[model samples]
Target: MPWSLHGGSHLPGCPGIMEEVDKILIRSLRLSGTEIPDEVQSIREFTTELIVESVVRCLRVINPSVGAGLSHILPPGMSARFRIGMSLAQACQDLGYQGEVGYQTFLYSSEPEIRRLLLFLVEKLPRDASEDASQPVGKSTTLHRAIAVAIKEQLAVPWVPPACRTPRLQLLQGSCLLKRFQAQPLVLPWESNLVPGKVPPERKEFFVKFLPPVSAQLPQTTSLVPSLLERNMAELSAAQDWESEWKSQGLGSRMTPEEYRQWKLQRLQRRLLDQLRQASPSLGPAQPGTTGRDLIQLLGSFGAGHERAGALAKGSRFTHTQNLAYKQEAEHPVQVETIPISRTSEQELREKQAAELETLEGELGRLVGQIGDLEGQMATLGLTLTQVEGEVRQRQLGVTEQEQTLRVKGRTVELLPDAENNMAKLQVVVESSAQRIIQLAAQWEKHRVPLTQEFRELKALHNSKELESSRRLLEIRELHERIRSAADEAKHKEDLYKQLLVELESLPKDVSRSAYTQRILEIVGNIRKQKEEITKILSDTRGLQKEINGLTGKLDRTFAVTDELVFKDAKRDEAVRKAYKYLAALHENCSQLIQTIEDTGTILREIRDLEEQIESETSKKTLSNLERILSDYRAMKQENTALLGRTRET
Candidate 1:
């Protein structure tokens, strides 16, 4: 048997394995007088080294002597650096790995490859050690090898934890790891040769000879290692010694490999129960009703108890049928009771009829309201008809009174001939005025003819006088030219006389002064006679022009009077024509008035006949209609009574 490490059972698994390995290393290092101030850091360093060494070992297993496989262990993009002299952390870090933390993470990695690698190391390392020691390896006298083989075959294919593997495989793997605690000569480097196997020579072997001899009996069965029968027998024998070592209490000899496995499983169960208790401390004893049932349930969980019937209390009220019903209730938590289809349909028909009845009742209410409104309207129409009848009678009385007044007016109208005579006398007076107007017009025409003739003669005379005045003006202009020429001649003669006097003064005593003086006096007398004659002619022409202007004014006045008389005669003729047109219009209007009177008499006779026919028709139709309305009203009342009875019955 291998010496067990202290606190090995208390430690859990993978991480616990790491911690145990670490403690061994620290103890060894401390024994060598190497003080580690921070033990955890030192342990991390050692674990990193172990991980790197394991990788190298795995690589060597692929191919010894470091061939192309060595490169496979390097991080993908790592340089081909020398790892021989380098620390594991430094080498791993240089390879782009996270050194110690990465090694721990990889050890617990969920990757199938990492898991396989770790298991492979655990399996190979101890077997290799046993081989080196020249000891029997894997030759145990037990059935574990077959079981381990079956488990390995079942878990041959890699799978994610808790999802793919069967519970049996999980239990086997767990048991196998627990079994590793008994491994001889611990496989970790720090633990090698540290645990001594034999007692020291200086110590007395007090219990060695007293210990029981080992048994050479083969297992009773080839199929089972530590079957339940053997385990129970061992437990019974061990019951007498409470303080005996659990390992030593085994039946076969001491704790056989099979008994050790059984004890370990029990211990694991105990740990689970303790943990469950810690998680829920209020887990009390089973209730009275469930205690016996729970005992049966517990017994049923045992593999061998499946064929046996449950044990029950003698006075218990439970039965197989009731248990089956309870089981069914548990399976289907909510129960739904079903009803018959006929009942359901009847309920639905009742609901539909109720809804229709409610609708009919509402319609009846509306009809009643409408009937009340119609009755009120009929009352109003009746009152209005009576009022109209009274008004018509009053109008008839007023029309009769007006007709009497019209008869009185007709007698007065019979005296219109006297007024006609008066009108005829007025007409004679108008005729006489017309004749007088005609006579006056003729006299005015005669008077206008002479004036027109006189105006024509005066116009002719005025034209001749205008021509004579123009001729006289031409003669006066000629006289003015002659006078101007004579004056110029006289001025020339005076200038000649002055020059002659100047010559007379410049001449000798022989120059003729008397001749020059005689010439000057003759010229002066001639100038005076010419000027006086021109003045007389000019005065005579001006007098003739003034007389001609006076005659033109007189002629204009005469023509204006003739124009006024002619305009008055035209206006009077227009006024007489207009008066004749008015007389013709009056005669035509009188003829139309006689025709209108005849038409009015015919229309009034037709209106009286139509009114008599309308009264006869109205009297007949009103009596028939009133009889029909009374019959309809009585029928409607009977129908309403019948409907009310039907509604009440429903």
Candidate 2:
């Protein structure tokens, strides 16, 4: 049987299923803790909103084009709510729901139906909706996702008044960027060079200094295409420069492109600051006690006098040395003195060089050994560090588990004293629940027996009625076929009659056609007389039928009054009881008789209708036509067979 709100036994797992459905719906709808009640039974105004929003969201996920523009909330007005409910019902049906669905199913929904519908909708939701975010995505998709996240975050922030907002903070606020750009007058290179020749001085001054911003000059509804285009072009140019720099120099730099760019920006800022400082006036003159001279000037001043004294001393010393050298040369001029020189042998020199080479080689070997030992120690340290890290992670995990256990144990300890009382309460609840279940089962049994009997009785009645209807339908179809056959026969007979008349006309002028005409008139007259008789008979039958109906009703009324009066007397008197019995028997006999008469009348009507059909068919000469058609068909068949035989022989 189809499911009904008032009927059907609840499944044992239905509550659990409903809970799961509620969780999925709550999560998907993003309902806050306070927006909806903890229990489904407590839902009121929010129920309609939740259901509508969830259905719309699921529909959109399933088929965006079809679900587009569907309202996510129920309307306040009764008619509109009804319309929305009807639409949602239709949409669900269109999605191929097998359950019985109507506007009432949504607007006046019960818990079970709501749970079923929500479960179906959740199942219909796109699989990709709950896909893992950790799944790989393309650069474009990732970029778009990031952009969406940024925009969402920006939108989530409360709006600040324009007056209190900073430019950076208000980047995503309204059309601030466009308004900012519009507030500035667009200055072109050519326009900057334009001289005001024909303008008045006052007008020129106003144009230069007091002109309103571009936004004021333009209409409020004016398009920002030009400004946007300019901005995009500027961005594009900067992007091109960045790309070029990154490829040419940034890649080879020790820093990343971003870091390199930052460094360049810092250098540019420093240069700008230096330029600004030079352009500005000095703070004050140098102090009187302090020299303004740089290191170069101070060093030059100290070295100048020292260099002159050294030159003069060198000149005086040179003269004295020359005189002394002259005296020494005069004394030593006559002596050809020869000094003896001692030189080491070639073998001794080679031995000393070899000894030094051996010492240097030994030192190089010692350093190589030390370097190898250090490398081994470094490798050992790295292995030890990795082991230590693993141990630390394990300890951290253990600590976390211990903390969780401790927390659970602490709660258990807190509840230790009340455990017995809780257990007693729980036992009482369980006993009460068991008793309630038994009571419910007994009540259900009480209702079920009567309902089941009634259902079976109704089913039997329905089956009998259905069979009667089918029989009547068959009779109707048979009558229709007979009528159609009669019509066709009539048409054919009319055509044959016309053809016969035409043949008679084409006959010789001397041929007697008066007798045929007279016969046709006589036949028509007889048919008219028969029709008149049939009509009179039908009128008489209708009169009899009305009288019978009136008599039947009168008899039923008399029987009811007589029985009421006799039943009272029958209780006290034996003869009256016998009389009452007789009266009841008479009434039953009369009712049966009436029924027989009605059945007879019905049969008579059907017989009359059959007779009329037969008469029509007879008048149309249907039998003769059929015989003629059969004869022609046989002749055709014989001719075809003869033709086939001749062909086969050939």
State which candidate has the highest TM-score: 2
Q: Write the per-residue lDDT of candidate 1 for residues 1-650, one digit (tens) a residue.
A: 13223323223223534343344434333322233455343243433234444445533443355522343233421112224313332333443442232332332222222333333333333332212222332323214654776778867956546655676756644353342111111112121112245444433243343333222122323313334346445556655343234323442233554466556666665555555434432244444445445444443444442443322121122333344446655776644335566667877767766886796567556655665565567557756766897799899999999999999999768757698886787799899999999999999999999999999999999999877866776675577668868998999767656655543454456534365345444444544565687799999879976986787677557655755665556576987556556655665686588579779988999998898667645633456546655765676677778889999999
Q: Which lDDT tens digits does candidate 2 get at residues 1-650?
A: 01221211133223433333354455434321123444543222235566677677778777788678678767755557668888888899999887887776665555556656766765565433532222333445546765987989998888898888877667767574553434223433123223335456776777778876555554553335556467557758877787667655665564775578667866665555445333321212223433323222333434423443321122333444454456655765534223332466667667766886796567546655665565567557756766897799899999999999999999878878899997888799999999999999999999999999999999999999888866776675577668868998999667656655544454456534365345445544654676698899999989987997898788778888989999999999999999999998888887788779889989999999999777645633456546745765676677778889999999
Q: Tell me the deviation in Å of residue 616 in model 1.
A: 99
Clashing pairs in 2: none
The 10-residue segment with the lowest total lDDT in model 1: 180-189
Please tell me which predicted candidate would have the highest lDDT against the true structure.
Answer: 2
TM-score, structure 2 vs. true: 0.23
For candidate 1, list the clashing residue pairs, or say none. none
